[model samples]
Target: MNGSDQTERPDGTAAILSTIGEVAYRWTREGDRLEWGGDALALFGIASAEAIATGHAFDTLLDDASPLARHDSLLIGADHGGGVPYQIEYALRPSGPRGPVLWIEDTGRWYADGGETARRAEGVMRVINERHAREQRLAFLSGYDDVTGLYNRSALLDILDQTICDAKERDVNAAFLLVAIDDFRLINDAYGYRAGDRVLAAVARRIRGRLRDGDIMGRFSGHKLGLVLMGCDENEMAFAAERFLAAVRDDVVATADGTVSITISVGGVAVPHDAGNREEAMERVQESLGVARDSGRGRFVGYSPSPERDAQRQTNITLSQQLIGALSEQRLRLAFQPVVDIHSRETVFHESLLRLAQPDGSIASAGQIVPLAERLGLSRLFDLAVLDRVLETLARHPDARLSLNVAPETAAGADWLAKFAKTVSQRPDIGSRLIVEITETSAIRNLDETAYFVSTVHDLGARLAIDDFGAGFTSFRNLRALRIDMVKIDGSFIATLPTSPDDQIFVRRLVELAQDLGIETVAEWVQDEETVALLSSWGVNRIQGHLSGAATLSPPWK
Candidate 1:
């Protein structure tokens, strides 16, 4: 087709195609001649259609890194009978220095001659700049935090894992720093969440600016950043931490709310030296950060291995392994403790406590196993195992009512609730007969999330209780918000209830408040009849202690 026949059609099809950012093209392989239709000059931002008249001239506009070229796509393929169809996405270089690079989706068919050599091709090219830009944005967000524009936690952990591997293979020292902005919550509370976010972004920028070229930085969590310093030993790590601390501390971040001075506490660990794996690295760095914060805010603490701490870690590791083995071997058991009415001394519901049997005929109680399980990230397994056993017990004993305590982590997560919902769906009768207890401390940690958890458990037809109630000193508003079925007063107050008048007053007031809110009160660790009498006089609903019965392996129903 000639230039006028290509660009000027009487039917106005060329005008319609150009409006939609599409252009038609034809190529003759013999003389490398190219022809374009539908306002090709405007669509491609070229001075004239003649600029791309030849195939060689058209190829000059393609990006150097583009995956495919026209000749490669048409000539490299096997010969077909009629025509071979193909589609490719590629970038086109700008015609001028100020022109924008365009992304094009080229789709067409190539025809072959009798000799099986490709000779001619015809195709339509559509601009896909918007779609390509959206895809590129999504790709960037996958590995980055939008707030700080830094690598996110997942990406940071992946890089840290590789760094650990490199340290072991190359025998090169590196350091991982877990940095937290000290008193960040104060900023959020005094200003607003938006101001707090501004501070976080500012702190991230400051820390990133101080890092070496080979180092990597990322947002590890809210108000915290993770940094990996290559070829850094303990001394160097400490020095690096100091530099970061000063970078944040010396500046006042300007936010929409106001200017706020910020300081950061850092915890550093020499990788493959103090920490051999990702988990160990994270754990040690967090421990050091905690120490730094505990000593004083805005300080740097480097991990130093100690015999006692090492021994404790080793013991924990051994215990975790044994616990895993015990769980697999079905040696994990539950002990039942009856929560009885204070006045009637009759059983209300039994609290199911976790127990693990040892090969030497001894048993490990929940107190021994739970904290360690939570620390070692085994609480989810324990929670699920306990839940299965509890469900089975409820199924077998129709008249038995049971309450079970879930770890703080489980209380904050959805997995336990999902399992409970599934089981209750299968055995509808068990839901009303079961109670889930979350510690008061855990409930107060994030009142909003705990309230949602309470609401979900109630919707699933199960009762929810706040365990160790007085320990958290939960506000009346939060207590009402949770809408729990019962509050078990912390054992510490009840342990010395009879002798301590202060404890007596506290217990009486707590019981009165719970009663006023229509929430049941259970006094734990009631040892003597005098204490029980006091609790009964105070109108405590239930009592669980040695006076009633210690948690026993033998099932009460059996």
Candidate 2:
């Protein structure tokens, strides 16, 4: 048969299409005629071929609101004249009109031959419906909470800002209330997270029920709700907050495990009257909330903007901005402190330390600026910058080994480690000479990631050390699980080791523990020769403190 005959006669198409699990069908553009054949009818769960051939209109079969329906005209585009095939997938209502929806992948071509009527037809097959459902779920999750079906933090913030702006421009009044469940952690601790979730959902329902018309309410964050009340003055705001507080006073949430009773602390602020912008307004409201929670649990307080509070927040903002600028400009300096082998009295390595250079030529230690950088989400950036500097410094001193402190977040995550591994892979010479020290708290808090990090660094020919070992619990557990190379004793324990018998016993036992695990022990805060002698007697392998040398700005070995 010629191409035109093949297009017109799809009687044998069902057998051919069924081999590939598709359905065959034909349609005409002029008359909008549709014909169903092959396994396509069976895939769509339509048993009545007569009804499909007689009553089903092409337009009605397409979902009215779908993009497929909007693009129906494109199916018969320029490809028709060249006899080029085209394809589009869309949802099609089933034959019975009351059955389930079926996704159809339709392929069609227009046929024209001398002395024969031109016709357009397409074949369609079943497709997995997950694609459509996934798109819908993503759209829903963008604005609404998956757990409680309330607006999420981002959506709430947008609405709150718009409400505040409208209040400013139109000279209207509004109030924002931030309600937090008091001691929510207690519930989570007693029960599991699932039970805690049930309690939170119950609280959300109660708060939502208390909201009046023209008011917007949403889940702001963990165990917190933000409510925007239209036309609410100071007095009305107080009453509304009290009403919301009273709603959950006697209500007990019933979970599968047991019942949970909860109370809330609320902070309210009059928009535009309490503060000008969203950030300022949120700060004032949060401060009021803090006051309420601090005064007593389950209490409500209204915001009173204070110049002192605003000034303090402004100062923090300025400092954070300056820190960002300094980091970008690479205005950070490194100080090196020597770690000496106790038995040999040989400086084995220098620990790299961080210092921030101020605009006025003075330097600020990492302790003074790193916490602020972390709070402002610059920790990773700062961490990467430190790595870059360490690499450069190491390249300069090829014969010397350097130990660098890693931020908890950067040390415990795969992203930073991947970058570190790639850099070391490029310059294999520095791998054996670099020692990464993770603080005790960071390692124990995220043990799994820490284990991964340890394996990765070891594979890259670098050594891993636990800094401030005795400062937290799980030191022994971490040593047993992680293949550590060294353990640095916290300075506080070492400060009194030469004088205090209790400290001597503790350090002795710690040293024995490290020796048993095949890990070297380094004693910090070695202040005197007596302390050094005591550390050596206890079998500590290395010592790091002022007794050996202060943290010098430049590495002497380099």
Which lDDT tens digits does candidate 1 get at residues 144-211?
A: 99899999999999999999999999999999999999999999999999989998998888888898
Model 2 lowest lDDT segment of ten: 1-10
- Candidate 2 Cα misplacement greater than 4 A, ranges: 1-173, 180-201, 212-215, 219-224, 230-246, 255-265, 277-279, 282-302, 375-377
The whole-model lDDT of each prediction reads: 0.88, 0.79
Highest-scoring model, TM-score: 1
Model 1: colliding residue pairs: none
Candidate 2: clashing pairs of residues:
23-40, 27-120, 27-121
Query: In model 1, which regions exceed 4 Å deviation?
Result: 1-38, 44-96, 99-201, 211-232, 255-261, 271-297, 307-310, 332-353, 370-406, 413-438, 449-469, 475-489, 496-498, 511-522, 529-544, 547-558
Question: Compared with the true structure, what per-residue lDDT tens digits does model 2 show for residues 125-150?
Answer: 54657776887799999999888888
Best of the candidates, lDDT? 1
